[model samples]
Target: MITVFSLIAGMLLTGMNYLVYRQLIVSFLSKKTGLVCISVITICTVIYISGLRIVELPDFLYKTGAVCLGLSFMLFVITLFYMAGKWLFRQVSLPVNQRKRRFLSLCFKGAIVGAGAGYVSTGIYSGKSLPRISTIPIKIANLQRPLTIAQITDIHLGVFLQKDFLQAIVHLTNEQDPDLVVITGDIIDMPPEAIGDTLDPFGQLKTRYGVFCVPGNHEYYYGVNGILARLAQLGITILGNRTKQIAGINIAGVYDLAALQLQRGPFPNLEAALETRDPALPTVLLAHQPKFIEHVTPDHRIDLMISGHTHAGQIVPFSLLVLLDQPYLHGLYHHDSITRIYVSSGAGFWGPPFRCGAPAEIAVLQLTEEHRSASFLRK
Candidate 1:
């Protein structure tokens, strides 16, 4: 099934590239430069798509292919915007003659294309820096000590990210001196061969209670068993549809939404995971996608749930689509007094790599004893 989809998508992309090449050569660029650009684009696309399928390529080439794919998609969007602008302008009466309108159309397309290219460049060049930390203080009734939990998600490490980026994430996370660190998944993009070295820095992260992770859809895309083994080797615990206890706080995690669809029995089982926990103690759940909350209820005794995977849409109009799909696209939402859900915009990016309104983040959750005056702060 996967192979069939890959083949169909590959053919469709190839056809689109051919059409784009024809349009560029015949209408957009000068004869000589058009040929050159067309050849370059075609070669790049072919090499990239081929690399995505060829398992034997050197790891660096595979990573390069992933980056090129992102660039190609960005370029496609630029073309789309240009086409849309042209169609929109034709509908309105311009305060100019045909010649002037032609010039304006060219200028408008140039501007849009330039803006898209600039965004792609920025996304690519913005090396992983210290992620912005937003700390939310929560007080539980039965917790004896103040506990700080750091949550990060969607560190898609295969391409456009390196050890330096991972190191920066680790440094920023360690600065909080978290008692426990939870990664809500999509930690790596490609297969282990493509990202093994790029993921090494994760091994350096220090957490007193250790790092816990649930698989994201991308992990399944990369081969779940292989990724799990590698994560285990790096000292990260994989909580696949299971629960664990830390300092009296029950931490439970479920597989990605895609996994749940394929393996339905594991999820909607918070009751089973929390069987040993007293009803008075606060429980935290790590779910990869925010939509999973639809299957849960406020009466589940789940105090807080952390999730990522939407990337807050990662782009503008696309984010609107996400809002329609997710109840809590980004930020915290209280489901009655017993259950609260916080959805991270994600610490890393996917697809085109650019993030518009959504910035990467590292969430610090300070769990304290419940007090009358306790409140949540947004930074």
Candidate 2:
């Protein structure tokens, strides 16, 4: 499946690059030089993106490759948009001369380049620096006192998210002095063999009720058992369709969809996880994907569901693509009268280490009494 996806992506990227080169870039250059430049760029783009999945390159090379891929895709999308606009103008009889057309194309290209650079800079700054703490106040019935829970999701501890990055996040989270810390998923991107000690910083994460996690799709990709073993070693409890009583509240988690798709194990059994829980207790469900809410029913006693995996589209424009599948992209969303979900953009990135439009965040969910519930009802 990985190989198939890589091939398909490579083809799409190659075609987009070729079209952009021919229409925008190569039009201004000599045929020979343009052909050579386009060919080289296309080859490098395909190899770098395709190799990212199969090869374990050095950190520097991996980051560089990822950035290049991101820029290439961004350029393609921008150029496509520009072409569409130009075509629309032509349909209205606003034909442009060769000189003016070239000038406009160059201007659009420059804008795309500028936007790409800004995105890369922001991605690096956001991913490498301490994450911004996002506080979301939620009201749940049957809660005795306010509870502050810090959520770290989609850390993706791999080439882009390194040990130091995790260390900084841990320190930042601890500073919040949260009552409980929940890891919704995508904690690691690399396989166990290649992960090394990058995850060592997780042990330093401090919370009153300890740290708990649920699997993300990436965990299954890297082998769920291996990730679970490592989490155990790190003293982080894996909540697999199970519930743990913390602060007198029922904290439940369902295994990621990847487990079912990979046929690695049984899908998360919500019934089993919630059956023993006291109905009066405020229940929080830790699901990795926000889309999981589609399966939620009115009978479920869950008050809050924390999730990640959308990355809020990771980049602008691409978020439209994410919205096609996910009903809720990021931030707090009320699914129904009884259930509310908070989807984190993510603590780290997956591929380019850069965030465009959507900034990475450490979501802090403050559970309050239902007194404010009427004012915060979902429209």
Candidate 3:
């Protein structure tokens, strides 16, 4: 199934690039040169989508491929729109000269190319920038005092996102002085060996309660057992369909539903995970995917659920496509009268190493008394 999907994605990207090259560049260049350029792009796309599975390539190649793919996709969309406009204008009678037509075409093509490059560059730069800290206060009954929890999710530390990025994020999170630090999922995308020095920074994370984590779908794709063991070694507790008590709060976590989707085993058992000492005490559930709320019941003891996985469509039009799958793309949403879920756009980027529409974020949730008015803090 993975192979089939990769094939389809590679073919689609190659076809789009080919169409863009034929429409925009072929007129200015020889037919033989255009074909060769398209062929090279097709081969590279195939190698990138599937060949990585068979053999490991340098980190630079992955970064280059991602940038190229993003740029090509943007160019393809621009060319398609231009073609449509040309067809529309052709329907009307218009006086034109060969040189003027060529000049206009060149100018429009140049503008689109410049705009596409700028978009891709800006997106990548945004992903690398420090994530803004967004503090939102929520009311939960049975809480003694306000509790602040800092959340970092989907920090896919691999290839483009390296150890330095992780370290910087950790530093920023520590500055918040949160009571608890939670990593929702997609903590790492590369294999253990490829992750070399990145794992140690997680150990540097400081919190009064502790650093808690739940498995994201990426963990399963990379290697669940190995990732869990490494996380344990880093002093981060792995909550696999289980509950833990911390700072007088009941925290429960379930494996990602992707485990079930991938047919891993009898995991992500929400019932077992929801087991709490005192039903009256406020409970928080750490679920990797937002859609997992479907398995929850209104009568359940959960007060707040934290999730990440949908980068809120990291890019523009792609963000729209994300809505087809994720229930809450980003931000806090009321799931029920007693239960609420906060979905982070993610602390980092996944693929393409770019973020166009959705800016990365670190969610700082302050649980206050129910009677307290809502408050938002930005830094």
Cα displacement (angstroms), candidate 2, residue 251, comes to 0.2
Q: Could you give candidate 1's per-residue lDDT for residues 78-183 as a string of tens digits?
A: 6676667768988998966889878886888678767976877665654233458978777566676788989989878755666787788888999899999999
- The TM-scores, one per candidate, come to 0.77, 0.88, 0.88
Worst 10 residues of 2 by lDDT: 370-379
What TM-score would candidate 1 get against the native?
0.77
How accurate locally is residue 162 in candidate 1, as Cα lDDT from 0 to 100?
62
In order of lDDT, best first, we have 3, 2, 1
Q: Model 3 over residues 237-299: C-alpha lDDT tens digits?
A: 988888898876788999988888889843798888876546767899999999998888888
The list of candidate 1 runs beyond 4 A from truth reads 11-27, 31-43, 46-56, 95-106, 127-130, 136-146, 189-204, 221-237, 260-269, 315-317, 320-328, 335-337, 351-357, 368-379
lDDT of each: 0.72, 0.80, 0.81
Error of 1 at 301 (Å): 2.0
